[model samples]
Each structure stands twice: as structure tokens, then as C-alpha cells.
Target: MTKGSVRSANGRPHSTTGGRPPGRPAHADPSTTGGQMTTGTTATTPTGPAPLRRPQWVRVLLVMLRALLVQSLWFWVWVLVPAAVAIVLLDRFGDLDMSVVQFARYGGIWYPFALSFIGVGIQFTVHVANGLTRRSYIRAVLVTTLLIGLAYAVLMTAAMVVERAVYTANGWAPYTSGHSASLVAGAGSLFAATALAFTAGGVSGLLVGIAFYRGGALRGFLALPLTVSPAVVVMLLTDDVAAGRDWTFPATVSTVPLTAALCLALIAAAATAFHLLARSAPVSKGLATS
Candidate 1:
């Protein structure tokens, strides 16, 4: 045998190349190796975070409607319960001369209470919607709360009309020209109430939605002013009007129109504030994933 070549016992020349063939291992390559190396280097990187999604306007509206529906039903129950109890107590005690129209007007006093509950419900709905969609916070709050408030106003008006008709038919009291004026006043009241309620609710919902996104206790505290400011103003105005105090000459000319305009302006301001606040809030931490 030549010195350069070594022969095995089987007579085959010994190979010069050492180890495995020139190719990737079963689990290794430039692409695969690079990937493994990169993964190992960034092992601390968090996983399982969900990507952010934009909210759909229509879906947000639907969620709001569903929430409002449940709230409205509960409010109706609340009103009915009190009225039933009053009727029973009155019947048991004596044949009270109070007409159905009077009872209906009295029942209308519960509107604010019912509205407050509805506002809370709407806030919750907006929070959920914001969580799911991470939409423009202002838009979500305004659209949802405004629609709910409008619907509530319409329902209350219809109920008032129905109650009035029933009372008139039952010979409780004849519908007078003054009643027509009163109805017009009531309509103005409804418009004002709707605007104020919607504005307050929208602001509340936006704040709550921000809380849901940011994870803080401040939202709860902020919610108070957002909801109560408009309410307080409306109450004071209504009280003044009821007391026959006219601070503004224009307002005195037609109290209803003036009140309605003021209420609408407040609602618009609230909506604008909600939108601005939402836009200013930080993006949700959990929603920052790519």
C-alpha cells in the first residue's frame, strides 16, 4: 500500500472526509439556524397578546340598543310597581278623586330616576364595546348613548299620550285648551331631557370605556362629574322654570324652546368633550400587539 493511502481490513481505501455529509442536519439550516438563534436571543419576548381591532359603528350601536332594551324594560317595571302600589293603597284607604291624568303626571316624576339607571347601563355597554373593538371612544359613546336617550324620550312621550287619552276617555277630566298648551310644554321638556340625559350618559360611557382600556380607579371618580353636571344643570333650570322664574327675556318668551335649545347645546358640548377625551386617551396596553 502507498504511504498516502490507508486500506481497511476489508480492502477499501480510508475516506479523507470526516463526519457527516455536507448538508444541513435534520433540524438545521441557514434559515432554520438563523430563526433558532433569533428566537433564543429574544426568548424574553412576550407571546399570546391579541392584536388590536377597530370597532364597527353598526355593531357598537347594536350593543347599545340591546343594553337599552333591558334597561328600558326594567325602568318600565320600576314605574309600574310604584304606580300599582299607589293605586292599591289609595283604593284601600278611600275613593280618591285623583284622575288618571294626574296619576300619569305624577308617575312622570320617576323619569329622572329611570334615566339614571339607563345611563349606567349605557356606560357598561360602551365599556364592553370599547374592549372588543377599541374604536374611537368619543364616537362610540356619543352614538350609543344618544340613540338610547332619544328612544327613551320617544317612549316616554308615547306613554304620556296614551295615559292622557285613557284618562280623557274614562271621564277623569275633559281635555282642555290648557291641556294642549301643557302638552306642548311637555314636548319641550322631553326634548330637553333627552338632550341632557344623552350628553351626560355619553360622557359617562366614554370615561368608563377609557377605564376599561387603561385599567385604573380614576375612571370611577371621573364618572361622577361627567354624569352629574348636566343633570344638576337640567334640574336647576327645570326648577326655576317650574317656579315661574324667567332669568332671560328670550327664554321667558317661550320657555320650552329656550330650554330645548339650551339642552341641545349642552348635549352637543358633551358629545364633543367625550370625543376629544377619547381621542386623547392612551391606547390600551393589551391592544398594542401587531
Candidate 2:
């Protein structure tokens, strides 16, 4: 209890310096066991989520798919619904040369195409931050693009069919525009043409988005032909103007099967190119953080 002496657990006098305990080395670590040197080793738990398992990746894909599908829903509500209404109104007032709904075909291509750009440019960082891998995000985007395209095709083909029926009921001739004037040969041909064109748009948008995202301005500019070619091919093979222009291959591939095959080939190629580019593309710190 006096200077240089402290009461031990047994009430005996224990020697001390600055109230240090007896029989303890001055430099000894409290963390170590008796007479054992401490290395400060610890079992490290990962800071974020666990390494992404197969099931986790699948869940992530589903979540992303759901979000994208919701976006598509809004697009259809805002664009397709109003377009359909306008077409019916306009057709009632006067005689029209072509199916007004046919013009909505371009909407099918451009809307999803623009959305594909946003999927990569804006959504990738968010996806990663949410503890998902880029691979999973890319897969989700790809699947969503295809699904959106198919949905557009179904809706557009149905609209055209309805418009044709209305035209017939009114004792009028129905014609197609943007696509081949002869495109509405059958429901099968119409669906295939719309599906291929819409899907091509989605894939072309992906190609453009990845090019700009991964390669910066110069490279993206240089890659424009490659990035934009899918949409161009679809337009050339399917558009009425292109058909009117007398393109050589356009004439040959104007049939339903050839058009479908060509469009599918373009979509496949563009999607693959996007995947390859995006897998190794650098994430910009400023952009990601911003």
C-alpha cells in the first residue's frame, strides 16, 4: 500500500513500478498467453458480402431482371398506349395509306436500344456496389434486353393485327410502312420480323453502350461502325425505304426466314462483342463514385 509496494492478491507486499503488477515483464503484451510471444494474429472476416456463390448470383440476376422489366413496363404504358390511341383517332377521321401502328415498330427498336445504354453506363457501378459481380450484371442485362425485345415484338405484332382487323371492318386497305410494304403476309412473318428488328435494336444499343463505356470517346467513335452495324443491318433488310433503294442483299434476304436469321446472327454477334468488351473494361473511379 506504500510507495514501491502494492498489496498482492494474497495480501503480501508485491513490488511495483508506477503501479505495475508483480511478476509481469515491463514490455509484455496483455494479449499473449503465459510466456508466449504475441504476433497479433486474427481470423479475418470479409469486409463486404461473402464471395458470390452460384445461388447468390442467380438471385442478383433475378433482381436486376425485375427492375429492368419494370422500366420496360413504364415504357410500354407511356409510349405504346398513347401511340395506339393516336392511331385509332387519326384513322377514324380520314383515309390513311398505311397502318399507323406500323410506325410504332421504330419505337420498339429505339426505346430498348436507349435503355440498353443506360443499363451499362449507369447501372454497372450500382450493381457492383450492391455486392454483385459484373458478370452477373451483364448476364442480367443481356437477358433483360432479349426479353424486352420479345415483349415489344409480341405487342407490336398484336397491335398490327388489331389494326388490320379494324381496317378490314372499315372496308379499307391496310399497308405497312418502315418495314417492307409486303411484310404483313401472315402472323408468323409479322411476328418474326418484329422480333428480329426489336432484338437487333437492343443488341445494337448494347454494343454502342459498351464501346463508349469501355473505350472512351476516341475508341468509341472509331468503333461506331461495329457498334451501329446491327441496327443498320436490321433497317436495311426490313425498312421499306431501304427496300425501295434497291439494295442487292436486301432483295435476297427480304423473305421472313432470311430476315429472321440475319437479325438473330447480328444480335448474337453484337451481344457477344459487348460481353467481351465489358468483362475486362476498367471501372472509372470518378464515374463509379459519382
Candidate 3:
């Protein structure tokens, strides 16, 4: 019989004077549990979000290519329409001494100026599409412009070759000096020259983009000078060269090297200006006016 059950008629089990069962864990105080003690050891802290990455070159390239393709299409239409009209007018009148080749050459010389306008359009479109930094956009523009200029030079040279062949086959002598060799060399030179010009222009456009991002409508006025300065210098030098005059110091520079040097200088100046402009704050007053 149990010790407590010997004298008690009730059937309940007796307490063992404050002794607990074997292997049972101790109980925590209810007051301590209320005061902020936790059972788990590890605490979970939240982390901040990661930064957004810069865009890839492929994305930038695609944006640039699309702008170029569209601009080129429009450019072609612009060239063709005027040419067709001119051809019709000439045919209606007496046949002139000028061949289609001559007309094409004249048109091609003016085409670079036309491409400047296209460059502006490309700048605007690229800004809208990529939201790229001014520098990145400028790089993309320069690359695209170089590619377009190269392609144009190649096509123009090929056309000249075909024209020469046709003229020869028709018993007309090609009158140009160093016609075949010049065609090849001139194509290379023109491509280089155009690339330099485009790079200069792109640098100028980058300045404009920065100005626009900061100064808005007033930036347009600033942009005109930046974009036109290279052309102005080039035109002046070319005019002097044509007149057989040497305007620069040292007085003995070759036309090609002088022109290339001037272009490179303009590109450098424009790039420097762009760098300075990009670092400055955007002009809120100008934006407000716009």
C-alpha cells in the first residue's frame, strides 16, 4: 500500500514534498517570459535592396541602329526625290554636259550637312529610348556615325567605279586625275575625314544633351555654336586651300594633315566641354521656362 493511502480513505495520489519527476526540464518563470526573454537564439535582421545595373552595350547598339536605319531611310527619300525631279527637268530641257555621276558627287558632298540634322534626331531618339548617361549616348552616336560614314564611302566609291566603266564602254574618256587610284584612296580618306567630323559632332551633341538636360530651350542656342564651329573651321580652311593660300602658322602644312588635325582638335575641345557640362547641375530655371 502507498504510505499516504494507509490512513486516508480518499483515493488521490499524495505529493512528494517538492520533489520533481526524473528527466523533466525545469520550468521558466511566467514573470521572466513576460519581460522580453526569447527562446530562439538567432535574430533575423532585414537587408536593403540592391542597386539597378547599367544597361548593356547590345541594348545601346540596337537603339542606335534603329535610329540610324530610320534616319537613313528618310535621307534616301530626301535625296531620291530631289534627284528624280532634277532628272525630269533636265530631260525636258536640252541635255547638259553634266553626267548623273557628277550630280551624285555634288549631292554626296552636301550629304554630310544633311546627316548633321539626322544626328540631332538620333540624339533625341536615343535619349528617349535608353535614358543612357550623356557619355554613353555620345559613344553610341560616334560608333553609329562612323559605321554610316564608312558604308556611305564604300557605296559611293563603288558607284564611281561603275560610272567609270560605263563611260569607258560608251567611248567617253574618264577625265578625272588619278581616277582609279584616287577612287580607292579618296574613299579611305573620306571615310576617315567623315569619321573625324562625326566624332566631333557627337561630342558637340553630348554637350547639347548635357545643356538640354540642364538648361532646356536655351541649350538649343548653345548647341548651334557647338555643332557648327567644326564645320565653320573646316569650311574656312577648305576655302583657303582651294585658293592656294596657307593661313595657319608654319605655313607649310599639307591639306589632309591640317584638316585632320583641325578635326581632332575640335573633337578634343568638344569632349572637354561636354565633360565639364555634364558635371554641372541642370539649369532648373531654363527647364521652368520650357
**TM-score of each candidate structure, all chains considered together:** 0.53, 0.71, 0.52
lDDT of 3 by residue, 37-93 (tens): 454444666687877665654467677687667766676567656755664566568
Per-model C-alpha lDDT, please?
0.49, 0.71, 0.50
Write one digit per residue (lDDT tens) for candidate 2, span 105-126: 7878888788887677887767
Candidates in descending TM-score order: 2, 1, 3
Task: Give the distance in Å from residue 165's predicted Cα in candidate 3 to where it truly belongs.
Answer: 3.8
Residue 15 CA displacement from its true place in model 2, Å = 39
Whole-structure CA lDDT of model 3: 0.50
Range of the 10 consecutive residues with the lowest summed lDDT in candidate 1: 240-249
TM-score of structure candidate 1? 0.53
Give per-model CA RMSD: 11.3, 9.3, 11.7
Name the candidate that leads on lDDT.
2
Clashes of 3: 1
